[model samples]
Structures are given as C-alpha cells and as structure tokens.
Target chain A: MTSNQDHLPTGQPDDGAPRGKVIVSVDAMGSDQGPSVVVAGCARSARSDSDLGFLLHGDSAVLEPLVARQPALTGRCTIVHADETVTMDDKPSHVMRHGKKTSMWSTIGALKSGQAHAAVSCGNTGALMAVSMIQLRRMEGVNRPAIACLWPARGKHGFNTMLDVGADIKAEAEDLLAYAIMGVTYFRNGFGEERPRVGLLNVGTEEHKGRAEIKEAHELIADHAEIGRYEFVGFVEGSDIPSDRVDVIVTDGFTGNIALKTGEGTAKLVADFLRESLKSSALALLGAMLAKGALGKLTARIDPRRVNGGVFLGLNGTVVKSHGSADATGVAAAIGLAAKLAQSGYHGRMAERLVIAAQAVQNAADASAQNGDRS
Target chain B: MTSNQDHLPTGQPDDGAPRGKVIVSVDAMGSDQGPSVVVAGCARSARSDSDLGFLLHGDSAVLEPLVARQPALTGRCTIVHADETVTMDDKPSHVMRHGKKTSMWSTIGALKSGQAHAAVSCGNTGALMAVSMIQLRRMEGVNRPAIACLWPARGKHGFNTMLDVGADIKAEAEDLLAYAIMGVTYFRNGFGEERPRVGLLNVGTEEHKGRAEIKEAHELIADHAEIGRYEFVGFVEGSDIPSDRVDVIVTDGFTGNIALKTGEGTAKLVADFLRESLKSSALALLGAMLAKGALGKLTARIDPRRVNGGVFLGLNGTVVKSHGSADATGVAAAIGLAAKLAQSGYHGRMAERLVIAAQAVQNAADASAQNGDRS
Candidate 1:
C-alpha cells in the first residue's frame, strides 16, 4: 500500500506549506475498531487545523490505503512501517522487552527523537504507559509519573483535572506534592487557567483527617502553592471532584483510579436509567420526543466522548492515551488535545514550574528541621 | 413540655398489647431537623408495624411535646430523659470522657443493658461510633468494627451492602477477612439471602493488582468462603459496586468512603442537570409535566432517603446511624432497618459466623505453613 505519489487533494488551501507546523505521532493500529478509525480521526483533525502534520506509525500496507480515502490527510500524512503490533493483553514488562518493532513503540519513539511534538495512541494502557516511561524518561527531579485526565465539571472551563488515575498504586508524601505541582501546571497550560486551585483528595475536608502521608502532603502542598502560582484548597473530599470548588484534585494512583472508574460507572447507570424511564410508558415516549432537543444538549455536555484522552504528565514528552474502544470521534478528541498541549509548549513550562515547586517543598522541610533543633 | 397524661388515640386497635415486641433505642436529638422529625418517623414506623416499640432517649421537655402530636406512638413509646446532646463538631474522645449524660450515650446504653434490641442515632458519626465501641465493646476476636451502608444497585434486593464506609481509615488483612465474614452475615440476615456473593474492592479485577494487604486478604477470603457460607468473587473494581455481579463489596474505610461520596456526588450532579434542562424551555417544561408520573417513579427508585441508614457491623449489639440531615422520611427508613435487624437477631448470629470464619482462616494459614516446611 506504499504510495509512489505523495501529493493528493488538500482540503485546505494553505496545507501545502509545512513551515513551523506541529507534528503529532499517531499509532494507527491496535484500536478495538482498527486503523480506519485512527485515519478518520487524523483526517478530521487535519481538516480543522492547517498547521498540524502527522507521522502515522503502523503497517504502511494497511494504513496507506486508509489514509488515501481522506483527501484532507493526503498531503499531511507520512506512514512509517512497523512489522509487529501490541495486543491489549500483552504485559507491560513483556512489551518493554520485545516491543521495539511495534507501532506503539515507534509512535512514542518519534516524540522521544524530536520528530513529533506529541504522541497519541489507543492501545494497551499498561503497555503504552510502560513504553512512554522507558522511552520518554521522567523529567529531572520527578520521582513518579502521573496520568492526568480532564473530568467534566461545573467549573468555568467545563472541566477539572485529576491526576495519578492509574500510573502507580503507591505515592509517598513527596510524590503527592509532586502530583500537586504537576496537576496545577498541566491544568494551567492545557486549559489556560492562570491560577488553578489545587485540592488534595481525602476522606474528609478537615486537615487532621485521612492517612498520615496525606496530611503531610497537605501541609507540603499548602506551603509550595504560593511559589507554584496556584491556590491550595486545604483538603477536598470525593464529592468535590465534579464540583466547581477546585480546578485540580490530587491523589495517589489507587484512590484516583477507583474514583475515576466509579464516576464513569455512575454516569452510565444514570444514562441507562433515563433510557429505561423514557421507554416505560406510551405517554413517557411521546414526552421524550417532545423534549429530545433539550435532553440532547444535556447529553452532549456530559458525554464521555467529548473529553476522551488521559494525558501522561511528568514525562519529558507528552503522550495522550485514548480509550481502546474509542471510535473516530473519540480518537479525534484525543488528537485535538495532544495538538493543544503541543502548541502550548506544556512540557517545557511544566518542567520549569516543577523545579521551583520541588525547591520550595525542600526549603520548608529544612526550615522545620532547624526550628526543631533550636527548640 | 413534659406531659402528665399517658393516654392518646391509638392508630391501631391492638397497640396497647405488647407481647413479643422488638424495641429499638433511638437518640431523639442532634438531627439537623430536630426531634420533631424523629418523633414523626417513629410514629410512622409504629403505624406500619405493631410489633415494634421505641425507647426514646432525650430531654423529655423537648421530646414529649413532639411525641404527643403523634397519637400512633403514644402508649408504645417510653421516654428516658438525658440532659446532654452530642454536637456535630464534638470530638469523639471528648464525648467518651464527658458524654455520659448525652442522649447518644444513653441510647447505646439501653442496648448494652438489654433494654432494647438495637440502637438508632442521627448524631455525630465519630461520637456515635466511639460511644458504641465503648458501651457495647467489639465482639470477641474482632479487631475493628465497620460501618456498612446499603448502596443502590441492580441486585435482586435493589441494594448491595458495602462495609467500612467511614469507621476507620485503615484495615489489616485480618481486619479485611473479618469484614468479609461480617458483611456476609449482615447481608444474609438483613436481606434474607441464604448465600451472598462477596467481592474485594480494588482498582482492578486482576489478581495481581492492588496493595499487598488486599492480595493477602483475597487469598484468605477465598479459603474461608465455604465455612462462611458466601461465594468469593475475587477482586472487583469500583464499577462493580453498582452492578449486579456482587452483593457485598469490602474495602478499607478510606477507599470505601471516597467511593460512597463520589457516587452520591455524581448522582446529585445528573439529577441537577436533568432539572436544569427541564426548566430550560417552555416545551421541555410541558413535556416534563406530561411525564411527571414516570419521572417521579425513577426519582423514588434512586432516592437516597429511601436507604438512609448505615449499620455499624462487627459490634456486640446492632446500631443504625442515620444521615445527620435526614428528614422524617429518612428517619423512618432508618427506624425500619433497625427494626428489621433487631427482629432477625442479627447480632448473635453474626458472632457465631465470625468465630467459624476466623477459625477457618487460621487453619488455612497453618496448612500453608506446614506445606511450606515440607517443601
């Protein structure tokens, strides 16, 4: 499927010029619905953004044909051949050892080698996380990497950022402090919030409640907030996650993962209940038809497809992991998010902010120690 | 406000007869709505069940005036005056020290002295748990008592039981094993299910996921499932909490509390969205009016007030803690649950089940040790 002729119809008039364009690496394989969705999503994204280019990584034989169908992605796409694919069931360690030739590995490799500004994939979460960590490496002074997802909320931006959604199960107080800084920086960069409010996730909002590590992290986060350019809302409970009370919620991976899934499950249950209720009676069915426009607007506002990517934070390069079962629309949303972060230069800015926040936490620790010695 | 007359109109003809009656001790102060709501709830409960009685503990000046308004609860209620009340902000340690005169203390004391079969309270959770732990004591071999709340689910009973919602922030492997046994016994006794399906709450359903203690607890629970008379469904994710796959979900207090609150917050959010949409346009309002009956049915099925009580498990006596902001309907639901558990003799049967399950776990550990030595 390798095309001898590279030039095809461009949907936009300025697409032929490629100077100062942001290039995103796309893994066009291993999605539950196959590479056609990835090509369609890329084509859709390219139609909307004239300055975006793609380095599509997969089997060129299969991807070239799919990309050929989209006139908008024709002059903008480049296919790199990858012989192997990473299955969803493949272990992360196994992928790290024997996944060099897979599309996921090559896609992230483009970001690591400076050929792409960001990477997007809809493959195995563990394998993608492992590959991203090993290939991209952690930023300087970063102890653990976190995955930050934008949850639909009642905030001004219509979304709130939460971190450590399943990167690792354990976090020390220092790791939690790092999460707070990273979350603040990501939210500000991704959503253009100047002074995001950061909250530590706990069982209770009181300072004295929760585990010892969370309490310590709370104090540390509060101390570093001023230097980090964010407001520290002492402690917030799970109920505050979807509220406008805070812009960023920080927690360890275990709790964050559980809360994330629980929210998704509850949303699905409510939607199911609505559907069943609408079909319960003849009168209800007629009423539903009359109210379809209003209900459709509400559904669009809460639809999971609108916000479809989990951005892996604290790495040298940005990697957005989409849902494995996402269709073209979901994949396009993920690609759009990746392009937005890449354009904002979020990685460099986050690195600079994290260094300052880390120093502030260290200084506070030293000051407390000296006071202890004097007393 | 104390009344000298003891006779009032009986809602039922045989209300004066008190043979084979089950009594529930209720702390009639500290609810957000006041004692009038509690009296109304008790009167509503008495009108429905003739075999139920109440030992009302509060200031007689406040409670007698309210109880006198409910003719159905006139002769069936016995007032025990307690001068103090536990404020919501009161610390548990302070209550244990200076709270003997509080109505919460006297309410639990009634159960401890065998004057009532169970105790119900809508006061401070920390103070109530502290008072119950001190007054009734933990059952033999029980390390930590858990607070189990019935979650709305798709199960046959329409609710699944979840433990350690907020009792304590930590749970050892042994404590988790004890929770498994206690949850099974409580579900079986409360819901009349001969065998309950139990799942260990974790971030994933995989055996290798979650913390170390959870992994160990999983093995122990599996081994003791037969003697415990429950089916061990292994690790379940947070999504399964509202699913029909399991009847009992067990976790540490920290995770369980967060999941519970998150679910509550999300449900409220969806309902808020629906209400906002219905009021968005005149056509939508008309449609909603047409479908009022079906919508009301849906709302009732998911109402938090219908399932308002969180039973304190693994205690020497049964204690039901209602929501602090519960209204008359919520209080009636809590009273109904306390009455059900009291009539079922749940406390004594839970003790017997705990002993057998604990022994089975110990024997399994010994067998594994001997096998290791032989190997």
Candidate 2:
C-alpha cells in the first residue's frame, strides 16, 4: 500500500507537510490484543498523517479476517504475512536467533533495510530491545538503549521528557550522562526545544547526597563544556517532576520504569477515587453534577491514553514503545508519536548530538591528564 | 521528664513508670533544619507518648539555646553532645571516620550500645544507612538491607507493606525471595496480618514477563514451603499496588524507590489538580461544598504523612526512617511505629521467619534437583 500524503502532527491536524516522509512499521501481532487493535490504531494513524505507511507483520490467517472487517483500513495499511509470532514469554536470546523470521524481528529488519523509518511495538519490551540492538546495532556512541516518556507538567510549558524507563537496570553514572544527552536531543527535536534543561533525579537536591555514580556523573555533566548549550540543572527530587521546573528528567532504567508505572497507577487510582467519592451521597451527586464538566475535562487531560506513547531513545533507529496494556486509543497515540518523531528526525538529531557528547567526554579526560602532567 | 497522662493509645494509662519504653536517639544536627525541628518533633512525641525517651545527639551549644526557649521540651528530651555533624555532602567512607563526634554517627552508636532501641533520622539517608550497617549490623539471614514502607492501598486494609525502597539496587533473584519473606514477617509483626499474600512487582501479571531475576524469584517463592504458607500470588504490576490485591509487594530497591516517589508525587499532583478543578466555577464550588466532608476524609486517609515512616527491615535492631521532609506529626507517627516494633520484638520475629524461609528454599531446591535427576 502506498500513500503520498507527507507528514501530519501527532494528535492535532496537519499544519504543514514535514520535510522527510518516513514509513513506520507497526508489529500488529506484538501487543496483547493481537492485530485488530493495532490495525485499527495503524488505520487511524495513517489517516491523520500523509507521510505514514504501515507494514503489518502477523499471521495472515488471523490478520486478514480483522483487516477484512475494516475495508477502509485495507488500502492505507499493508499486511505482510509472517507465520512466526514472538510470545511474551519467549527468551530474548531465542528471538534474536531467527533475525528474519518472527514478526517482531522482521519489523526491526524493515527499519534496518530502510523499509520503515521507525518500528513501533507493544510487544515483549525485552525481545524488542534485544532484536533492535542486534538487528540495527547501537549507534556509534550509545552504550545502551533508553526508553523516554513525555510527562505532562502542571503549568502550560508542556510535557517534560524522562528516560531509561526500562532498558538498562544497572546504569553507571556515565550512562546517566548519555541518557541526559539523548533525552535533551529528543526534547529538542520532538518538542522543538533548542536548549532543554536536564535535571538528574535524586533523593535530594544536594549534588553529593546520592550514590557514588550519581555524584561522579554530576561532576562530569556540570563541568563538561560541550553540554553548555543544554541547561544543566542540579538534582531534582521526585516531587519536582510534576512541576515545570525542568524539561528533561534523567535516571536509570529501573527507577524510570517504576516512576512511569507508579505515575500511571496513581493516576488511575485518583480517577477512580474521584468517581467513587462523587457518587457516594445525594448531595455529593448534586455537587458532581455541578462540577461534572470540569471534572470530565480534567480527567481527559490527565488520562494515560492522551499521553500513551514513549520513544526508546539512544537506539540505532527510532523505536517507540507503547504501554503493553494499552488499548486502541493508547496504541493510536503511540503511532502518532512515532509518526511525529520520524517526521521530526528525532533519532537522527539525537544520534548526531550523542557522537559529539561522547567525544567531549573523551576530550575532557585527555585535558585532565594533560593538566595533571603539567602540574 | 515524666508526665502521667493518657495521651496516646497504649496498654495502660500513664502510671509515671516507663514500662516497655523505647528510647530513640535522634541526630538533631543531621537534617536540613537542624536541631530546632528535630527537638520540636521530639517534644511533641514525648508529650504524646510518655513511655518514650530521647537522647538527642548534636552540639550542646547550638541545641542549648533552642532548648532554653522551650522549658516544656527541656525536661522531656535530654541532649547528648556530639560536637560535629555529618553534612549531607560527607563521604560515606569518611562518615564513620569522625563517628565519635558527629551527631549522626553518635545517634547510631546509641542504638549499638543499647541506650536506644532504635535510631530515627531525617538526615542523609545514605550516611545513616552506612552508619547503621556499621553499627547495628544486618539481621541474621539477611544478605542485604531493605527499606520497607507501608504503601496505601485502596479499600483500606490498613496499608500494604513493600520494600527495598532505596537500598540493595543490584539485587539477585534469591535476594528478592529473601525480601518477600522479610516483608511477610514485617507485615505480620508490624500490622499483625495473618498470611499476607506476597507479590513480586513486574511489568505484567504473567509469571515469565519480567527479567530473569524476577522469573527465578517467582519460581523460588512459589516452591518454598514457608513462603507458600504466605500465599505466593505470583507477579503483580504497578496498578495492583493501589488495589489491595496483595498485602505485601516486593521488588529491588531501585524500582521500589521509583514506585515510592511516583506514588508520592502523583498523590500530591492529583490532590492539587482536584483542588484546582474544584475552584473553576461557582457550581463546582457548590458541589465541592456538598461533598466537602467526604472529600476531606478521603484526602486525610490517603495523606502520605499518616504512613510517613519506613522501617529499615533487615537491621538487627528496629530502625525506622522518617521522610527527610517530614513535619512534626510525621516524625511522631514514626516514633509510635518504632515504639510498637520494639515492644513487639519485631526484629527477632523477622529473624526467626527468615531462617525458616531460607531452609524452605533450600529444601525446595533439593526436591527440585531430585525430580530433575529422575526426569
């Protein structure tokens, strides 16, 4: 299937045709709901953007019936038959074994072969990361891939980008600097921020209060001349995240994962609690009627579906990771994010910046050595 | 120093006898605000709980003025002069170097010397953990120390205990099993729960969805006879945390810290958002007025301050960690928690449970080995 529509804005209407028209391949069989929800999302995404195309990878038997149900989805999205499906429980090593057979692996192959600008998945995140790494390989300087999510701040300044959501569990302080650079590049490209402020997530604002790695990394980033263009704010506690104090919040993958999940869970709990509390009594119900519109608007704004997608930054090619349990709406949102990132050249800009950042880190070491010798 | 009053819910009315009393050594100079707030919290706690005593550790001169300003506090809390203070920036290695003089170190020393049953700190968490490890030591059978917190669950079965909130970042699968058993013991003793169901936090409810360590730990816990006594309900995602589906949640320190912070941040954000939305229009305000009491009760119930203190579960002696930013009420609640733990011999029970659980794990391993051989 071919379309000559150019690119569109993620959620809103297309303002102008994007510079680069890039195809994004969606692994239809990756998520829990299988090809139907993914196909519907892909259909919705493809309709919104001109430059987007989908290469649906799944069992033709299962996928064809679902695609047949939506005739409008037939032309915009292409179904590429692949008998292999990656189970959520499958070993990452085993999936990496057949690089071209499985839908998940083949989707990454599509990116490597330039059939797709980026690959989006709600599948086994581990297998996706593993396949992405082995197939596309890491960019010149990136040590490990990081999952970056856009978090909405309280004020009007917009969402803050955070990273290392679930890719690397035990990241060193140096790895954190990489996350900072990548996260900054993402915000610069995706959010169009030239110089985003990067805040290191710590238990306290004091630079030396965290672990040895955090302290060491703090010195490295704060002193680096190359990072001068990017605003390097000091430590930010978890409380500062919802505030519009910083543009990029950087932490290790383990912490980032927990933060994302907890934020999601708490938001759900809050929404549920409000609904239950509002209907408890007749007076409360009357109060709810008066405040219904405002509450609805607030819920819609804070809904996880509205902010469904996150990009896996620092990878060789763009890989957007949607929440595994995301429904059609969330999936659609993720597709939109991927489409926008592809149009914005988010990965390319980040890759370029990372190379320079890595070199600067090396140069600083050499300068430090020279100074020591001179003394 | 003594007052006969039934201020708090204790077994007996104040009899002017300090029966089953708990003396907490506070590092008055450890926190950001210094001795004043610590002293204030101490006095409040002392007034509320007559069976409590304090050996406030800090510089006598600095504390003397603050003590002199409040005659009521002077008799309630006694000052132990520790000339130096461990600044937040002090190196953990060097933290204990001047242990004899620093307020934080001396406070820990009190716990070590049996002058205090527990040491409370709102200071440098890392330094406190370091000094505590050096002084009080880890509980027998615990390979790594864990910071256990009571997570507020929906439907109010009190609070669900979970941990390794900020300690043991790089933990093994076996360590997680140890944490689960430890958490079960903690919930049982601290909250008096019978057969608390334990869940390993993962990306999904599926047993094999998580990393290798989680999968292994899941199998280990499920098979262990002692662990089996407390329902090993398998994997739980972040959403399950607030649902009260499980009474105990176990994960590594890295994720636990993130989850804790995320919960705190989101709770505050939601509360703020609700308050903001409620003020948008006259009707909304009217509605809010109608449900004011219910909303107030709900807010008070979910307030993090009520469950502010976290127990450093794997310590040989009961060491409760109050939030660094906790106010007087939070500190008092923590003191009450510590007192109860000390009174209940919580540490000893934990030790006993751990030994049994470890033996069960070993037995299960041997049985599995025999089955594998036969196969």
Candidate 3:
C-alpha cells in the first residue's frame, strides 16, 4: 500500500538547522463522529497555535477535501495516506499483529520515526495502547505503562492527575510507585507545577487500611518522594480524588478505571438532573433563561470536552487517547494537550525523573534488606 | 452502672405471651450530634410505626432526659445502661477487646442474645463491624460477611443495592459469590423486588476484562443464578451502578467503597457548583428564587439522608449502620430500615438463600474438578 503520499515532507529541517516548530501526528479517522471532527479540531488547533504543524494520517483523498475547507490548516498540514482504520471492536492483540497499515498505527509510527513530536488519536483505546507499546516501547525499568488523565478537582489548578486509568488490570507495588512518579512528572510538565503532592488511593486514609500492595506502594512512594521531586501526602480516600489536598493520585488500573468511569457517570447524571429541574415548569424555564450566562459558565467549567485526552505515560513517545465519541471541540482539546506536552519536552523530562526515582527505590530496598540480615 | 433502666420493660409481652412488636436495638451515644439526635430519631420512627419498639443502649441519665423531651418515644422505649461509648477514634481491635460495656457493643449484644430483632448504630464503622462480626458471627459456610447499602440509581425503585462497601478490603471468588447472594437477597427483602438482577462490578462489561477473581466470581454467580433466585447480568461497569440495568452490583469492599465515596464526592461537587451559579448575580439569584420549588424537589430526590442505612449481611442477625455524622433524619432512616428488615424476617430468609447458593457453588467446583480428572 506504499504510495507517493508516504514520501511526504517529514517537517524536519535538513541541513543541520535548529527545529523551530512542534509537529503533532494526527489520526484523522476512526473517531465515532468520523474524520470531519478530527479535521475541524486540527483546524481549530492551527488557528490558535501558529507554530504548530500536523502530519495528518489517513486516506489523503478524504482528508484533503476536509483540510481544503480550512485555509489555516492547509499549509501547516502534511497528509500521509493509510489504507485502513482501526475499528473500536478490534482486539489489542489483533491490532498488534496486523494493524501496521491502519491510520492509528501510522500515527504512532510518526512519533517512533521522529517525524512528529507526539501523537493524538480519537480511536479504540486498547488498539492505540497496543500499537504504541509495540512501536514506541516502554521506558527503562518501567514494567507497565500507565494512562494519566487530568481530573477536575477542587484544587488551585482546578485539576489533579491520576494514572493507571486502564493500562493494565493489576499493578504491583513497584508498578504503583512507577505510576506515582509518572503522575507527578506529568502534572509538573503538563500543568507547570514545580512539585506536585502525590496521594495513594485507598479505602481509608489510615495507615492500616486497604490491600497489602497499597500499603507497600504507599511507603515506596513516600521513600522516593525527595528524589522524585514530589511530596507524599500519605493515603487518600476516593473522596479526596477531587479534593484540593493532593495533585496526583496513584492506584492500580482496576480501581482507577472504575473511579474514572464512575466520576464521569455521576457528573452526567447530576447535569441531567439539573437540566430536568430547570425545565420542569414555565417559571423554572423562564428563570433558566435569565440565569443562562452564569449557568453556562458552570457548565463550561465541568465540561468533559474541555479536558478530553488521556496521556499514555512511561513510553518512548507521547500518545494521547481521546474519547472515541468526542466532538470537534473535544478533539481540539486533545490536540492542544498533545502539542503542549510536546512543546514542554514532557516525555524526555518524565523519563529522567522516573530513572532517578527508580534508583532511589532500589537503594532503599537494599538498605532494608541489609538491616533485616543484621537483625 | 446498673440502674432502674436495667429493669425496665424489654417490650416483650407480659404474662409469658409471644412478642408482636419488632424491637430495634439503638446505640444512643457516639453520634457526632450526640444522644439527643438518637432519641429524636427514635421518636420519629416510633411515631410512624406503632408496632416498632426500641432497646435504647446508653447512659440512662443522659438518654432519659432526651427521651422525656420526646413524649412520643416514652411508652415505646426501654433504656439499657452502658457505661462506655465507642469513640470514633478507637481502633477496631481495641473495640473488639475492651469495648464490652460500650453503648455500641451493648446495642449489638441485644441482637446476639435475641432480646431485639435487629440492631441499628450510628457509631464508628470499623468498631461496629468488628463488634458485629464477633457478636453475631458469620452464617454457616460463609467465609466473610458483607455490608450492603442501597445506592441512589435511575432504576425502577430509584435505587440499586451494592455490597462489601468496606466490610473488608479483599474478597476471594467465594467471598464475591457470597456477596452476590447477600446483595440479591437484601434488595429483594428491602425493596420488595421479587427477583433482583445481579451484576458483578468491573472496569468493563466485557467477559474477559478485570481481575482473575472477578472472572471466576462471574462464572460462579452465573452458574448458581437459578438456585440463588436472581438473574446474573454477567458483568457491569461502574456507570451501571447508578443505572437501571441491574438491581444488585456485587464487588469487593475496596472497589465498592471507592465507587460509593467517589459518587458522593462528585454529587456534592456538582451541587456546590450549581448553588454557586444560582447565587452568582442578582439576576441568577432572582431566577433561582423563581425556580426554588423545582430545585427543592430535585435536591430531595438525590438527598443521601433519605436512604441512609448500610445493612450488614451474611451474619446471624441484621444490623443497620447509619452514617456517623447522620442527623436526626438520617438516624430515623436507619431505624426505619432495621424495622423493615426485622419485620420481613430478612436474616432468616437471607441465611437460607446463602446456604443453598454456597452449596451450589461448591457443587460447581466439584463438578469442574471431576471433569478435569476425567479429561
């Protein structure tokens, strides 16, 4: 399926010149709303960021028509044709085996080949993770990769970063510690926090509660906090996930995934309830109209579309998995996040921090072992 | 500490006659608001159900004055003197060892001794669970007891039942199967549902996702659905907990507790945001005033106090735990739940269901083993 489109410009300066712009790989297909939303989102991103460029991966015939509609994105984008798209129903293993020619795979490939700084896709989460793992590979000493998402919280930054949102079903003590390091680094780089406070998610804040692995992970994270450049806030209950006390919450993939989905579901339910109440009567409807501006502000503050990307951490390259059903606005938010991470050199900084933290953990373990032998 | 209160009527019929009233044991101390709230809650419950009586366990000197203030509770109450109170800060093990004379212990003691049909306490949850496990004991063939709570959902009953919401942190496959049995039975008895649909809570509804024990529990539950007298919906996600798809969501204590508290936190956050918006400006305030009636109705629908009891299942007797910070209304709701469970003979019926379900699970395991051997 190799074609003339495969030879498109890599957006990299040749002649040993300094790179002046951040290029983001965009998978312009496989979204539930179709390629139009992806193209529109790219257009929006290009309008906001003049220095941003895109290596759009999909059928060039289809993407060209959409890109032509937006004059701002036309010159900033390079269309690379891919024959196939990764369907949401495709298994991660199936994608790993036979998805090389798909848009999702090609998008991640751009990041691996150094043609793009980061990758953004509104496609199947499992397929994307599988492709990214195979192509980009995990970081050194990282047993499992985690997906970090910025959750809306009652904090100074109005959000907290939580990881292992569903990279794997289980997490060992070391895996959880890795998650803590990754979450802290992600928040620091993505949101510009100097030193984020990390909390281990558990049933209770007490030292005696929760599973054994959680307690072990808590101590490990606490021990490496200084080297990791983050403060350990001990254990935090589920309620504290949205509280201001902690900026990074760490947990196994199972709990994190359930909590993430539960939070989303609850938010939607409350919003629906509020809307139903506001339209219950003629007086209520009229009042809603009068209060539209303030209500709109509240709605915008909690809008999932505003913060729509889940960043894949502990990998060689940055890959953001947006919600499959995201609209143009949500897709734009994901692309914006990817560009910000790339511009800030998040992946390289995160790797450096994790390596230091991992060594400190090893040192602590060795000391504890020697102490046990002496006793 | 023995007083005239100790000799007070037990509410059992005089002249050696059979008891007709459903007597609920109440711990009148250790609430965040203290004894007055408990007395007021008991009085409120008494006013609604004439056949409901209370064995109030606390210092008679403190409770007598409060009971006298509520004249409706005078004839229907029997105060029992207990010299100590289980402080919220006390550890569960400490309570299990040295909390014999505490009001929380005395309240549960009445159920073990069969002096009261059911027990209701608004004390420290960890201490209460410890006392109940030691006092009532787990039912036959049950590995661990579970705490079941009715969650606000979009179901036909406007709620769904979830179990192991912090009774213990870990649950094996057998323990999960037991939770399913207990949860289904609790929903049927409490909400008058003829046959509740059971769903194993996981990160995804797909059969191959989640922890190993979760998958095993799914098959066990599906195997015994007919004998357990419930329909197994295979697996359900966190969002399904608040949806109408299932009536009982079975999970380990860790996930259940996190999901429960997360939902509570999200609800409060959304409510706070809505209130702030409504009061942001004079126009918004005026609009809120016009829509106050509908908003009040909506608030009442999601009010936590309206359904405020967590029922401890898989034990020999029924125990309902109210929120430690519960007010008079919340305490009343707990007492109401205890009375309903007592009146419906929930403990005896649940015990029978569990026995049969447990045997079915054992039989399935044996059959699987035999098949393996034959192969």
In the range A133-156, model 3's lDDT, one tens digit per residue, is 999999986989999887888887
Clashing pairs in 2: A5-A50, A6-A50, A6-A51, A287-B287
Q: For candidate 3, what is the DockQ-based docking class?
A: medium
- Chain B vs. true chain B: TM-score per candidate: 0.91, 0.89, 0.92
Indicate the worst ten consecutive residues by lDDT in candidate 2 chain A.
A1-10
TM-score of each: 0.91, 0.85, 0.92
Of 2 and 3, the candidate ahead on DockQ is 3
Give candidate 3 misplaced runs (Cα > 4 Å): A1-20, A60-62, B1-20
lDDT of each: 0.84, 0.75, 0.84
Tens digits of per-residue lDDT for model 3, B161-270 = 88889899889999998898888877776566777999999977767677899999988889888888898898998878888899999999899999888888888787
Span of 10 residues, lowest total lDDT, candidate 3 chain A: A1-10
- Better structure of 2 and 3 per TM-score: 3
Cα lDDT of model 2 by residue, A1-375, tens digit: 112112112322133324456577888888887677888877667666566677788788888888777655666667777778887877777788864678887788888888887788888887888988887888877887788887767745557878877886657876888888888877766555667888888766865466678887787777652554688888887777777788889888767776777787887887777787777788878878888877875776577776777777776777887777778777878877777766665565566767887888888889999999999
**DockQ of candidates 1 onward, in order?**
0.60, 0.44, 0.61
Model 3 global lDDT (CA atoms, 0 to 1): 0.84
Candidate 1, A145-185: lDDT as tens digits: 99988787877777898999988888988889889889887
C-alpha RMSD in Å of predicted model 2 compared with the true structure: 5.4
Ranking by TM-score: 3, 1, 2
